[model samples]
Target: MTTAAGRTLHAGALLPELIAVRGIAAVAIVCAHALSMATRGHGGVPPSVEYARLIVDFFFIQSGFVLAHVYDRTWREGRFHYLTFLGKRLARLWPLHVVTLLVVAALVLAGRAAGLETENPHTLWSFAVTFLMLHSTWATSDLAWNWPSWSVSAEWCAYLAIPLFFLAADRVRGSAARIAVGLGLFVACAAFSELVLGADIVTLTYDGGAFRIIPSFFAGMLLRRMFDDEPALVAMSPRGYAATVGGVLAACAALIAMNATYDALWPLMVVLTAALASRAAQPKPGLLRGRALAWLGELSYAIYMTHAIVLQVTFTSAKLLGIGHTFPQRAALGFAALIATAVVAQAAYTLVEKPGRSLMARLLSQPRPARAFAAAADRTGAGR
Candidate 1:
């Protein structure tokens, strides 16, 4: 099927393993949020929870790879319609964003009415920023409503720059050169962020977070380019693919064991994402390609967007019920919260996101009446 950007994307164009990874990333992020809540105002966050923030970088990289895989060809052929592209991206992201923002707002109002303190930003300016998807820009702090949507906000900025990024990538000539340059750029950007900005890339907020996403996004494009140029890498045997995946998993285990910081593990993450993406292109039945993982992957975006809200509600309700202070109780409640998040995300995907996207696509694809009339007039004049 061709996307609104006029890019042809076959069903197989989507790599199942990548989808599975998305599911995993979504879960990690949710766990991280839940853990943070459980440990609120407490020091010593578990290393696993702390490192889970790198999943956002993985998200950026994956997005870049997927977008390039689907749209780069059309872009190179000069068929990419920027407005249509932006509309499609907005359609995909905005509906759930608005819904979650409203949910958070209502929760805040209820808390206030009950004489409870809510962490949500209740000001008009914050609402406007969240609605405009500008919450991650330098102009604002982290959004009070739908705090997790900060990544989505950062992604919006990347989506706006994708065309230009692709244009630059197109000029790099060879896939090897492009990949090399992309890695170099990533390192440079990481250094600048760490050294000059004096901010850990993983902990970046505001405009700093926006800067954090660019390198991974570009690296993802480079990975796609390399995959396209070198079929051998993706043509690995099933055993070889399994081994590569196993190695990546082992590395993740080791990182967790060592309690590596997000900064220490991000480069490894980029390499592993690239490697796994390459392996995913192979026609093999990997663990990540399992039905359960695939389902979670399909719902990953909804999960990412709604999980924080779900966590907050779950914890708040638990607190009201006096069920969360004890470790065992909190653990049980957290598990239940995860289940609830999945259920709610599934509903959002089926009822809101899918329909909203279809509607938006149809609306954006329709021709303007004035343009239609002008075209008809030109045709009539030609007939004369």
Candidate 2:
């Protein structure tokens, strides 16, 4: 269904362009990590790839936007259970996390046995914290096993705050109020990053990073409100929407190529993501509707979750083979690793991630018989 405001609602209200963007972002992240691995111990990766990490904030923003679109009404109706919501989210995240952690642990052990070096942690404390998804909450100094899972942990933290976040968003009636809240959340986090972490907001990970996602997340939520209510955005033509998306992304590329500061890149990402989302709402979002893009988007989570393991294995193999010492060879290996990560992510999605999510929902989301019985009794009493 398409809203009067031009918002397209698919099953679960999934936004096509956003999903494709996610797929694109996931691949970019994999590419960045692979580049870093290939260049490990020698020097920095390219400046463009160095800033690819900022793409992670888009995930936060998308999460906030999509979740608000999907769940805000149910919440307003007073029937959205926190446990049920959290359980479903955990079901979505936990399975792949478990699989990746195990895979990384094995790789770490085997790499040690083979006298190959890896920077990933292997200590018991790190293991415990990562297993419990507490590593990003400052339970450890660095990420342990499946280091990218730090974002997953941070997402879990955001999930925990959804009830409060949603309530606050709902109470704030005016667009100005919502915008202020959104900007404040981001600015506060950025201020804290500069004061405490001595870095930009996007640079945080595995060091009180659980809170890092708040600003972008709220920005996404507020953007959803604008998408629904703003006249200029609502009346934008599909061609114009596409142009906005292309323009924002092109601007981002140009800036990155020019070695733009993180400060300059951050707001651009927000605009780029918003444009993609708005374009997805169009009835005919050319090219973004391709099956291949949709397939990648469907597998985006798995790709994001599983690629680190592939990178580690590829790096280890390169080390053992005594190759990839030069920049060209490392670039070639990184490209090859991207392809390998895609394959593994496809398998992980088809096998473990999808089924595990369904199984977890079944196990944790079953309705309580006692509550049902009590509800029935109350109805019967009312009739009597």
Candidate 3:
């Protein structure tokens, strides 16, 4: 799908397995949030819940890798239109973001009208920050409307600066050296966050979110470059592929366990993300490439954006229907809420996300009538 500008748009590069990983990560996040809400600010959380926070790191790294895989050649060839790239990325992300933002706003208003005590009062400032995708740039403010959107805000920042990162990465010589530099920078950033900023990279808010994304994102880009330079690396035997996947999973589990005590395993998380993404890019027979998992991957963004709203609405409805406060009852309701979230997310993907993307692409891709007419007049004048 290369444009006239020599920009290659490789649709086949859409890695289904990686997409499945995204869906799984989204599910983990939903479970983590649900557990947090269920516990009502209690200290106890499953290891999975705590570990799920690292999934955002996976997202950052994956974004870098995927974008680089798709667009780096276009950029190198000088056909990468900044506005076009930004518009496409926004079209993919913004439709769902706006839909979910409005949904949350409506829910907040409805709750207020019914005299229900809402934890986060809707404010114009919060709305403005969220609508502009700037909520991840500051520390003091919170958008209770859609709390998880903070990451989307951070990702928006990344999308805007991707070209700059790509340009910087272009200057590097060898893929191995590039990867090493990226890893070193990532570790340095993590150390700075811990030693100087006195904040853990995992739980950092606002500005810290921006800091958290940079190293991992570039590391992903470097990893993608490595994949391109070394074909043999991606062409693993079935047994070797299985072992690589198993090794990464085992390492992740060990890191998650260590994180429970040490709290400084974020750099290791970058390595795991890169490894998983590199392997996932290969055409391999794996569970991640199954039809169901692939479909879930396609719906992942919708799930990630809408799950919080779904959970909120479900719990509110449960309360209205006099659901019991017992732990067993709450657990059952939570499971039901999760299932409902998936259904709603599927509907959102089918209804809002797909249509909105198509509409946006068509609108953005079309040339203005005025421009066309002016070009015609110029050609006519030249003929005379």
Cα RMSD to the true fold for all candidates:
4.5, 3.4, 4.7
Q: Model 1 residue 117 lDDT?
A: 84
Question: How do the residues 1-384 of candidate 2 rate in per-residue lDDT, one tens digit apiece?
Answer: 665465443325668888887898899899788878777766877677878878898898889888887887778789788988899899999999999999888877887787865665579899988888877887887767898999999999999889878877877666778777777778788888899888788888898677788888888877777665665555567778768877877888888888877656666667776777766556754687799999999999999998878877776688678988888888888888899989999899989999999999998966599987998999999999
Flag the better candidate by lDDT, 2 or 3.
Answer: 2
Give the RMSD in angstroms, all C-alphas superposed, for model 2: 3.4
Sorted by TM-score (best first), the order is 2, 1, 3
State candidate 3's TM-score. 0.89
lDDT of 2 at 344: 96
lDDT of 1 by residue, 265-288 (tens): 666666777667766555546667
Candidate 1 — which pairs collide? none
Candidate 1's displacement at residue 383, Å, is: 11
User: How many Å off is the CA of 237 in candidate 2?
Assistant: 0.9
Across 196-274, the per-residue lDDT of candidate 3 in tens digits comes to 8787776665656777788878887887777666655555455665676677678767766675532345555555555
- State residue 240's C-alpha deviation in candidate 1, in Å: 2.4
| Model 2 segments more than 4 A misplaced | 1-12, 41-43, 367-384
TM-score of 1: 0.90
Candidate that would win on lDDT: 2
lDDT of each: 0.79, 0.81, 0.76
> What's the TM-score of every candidate structure?
0.90, 0.90, 0.89
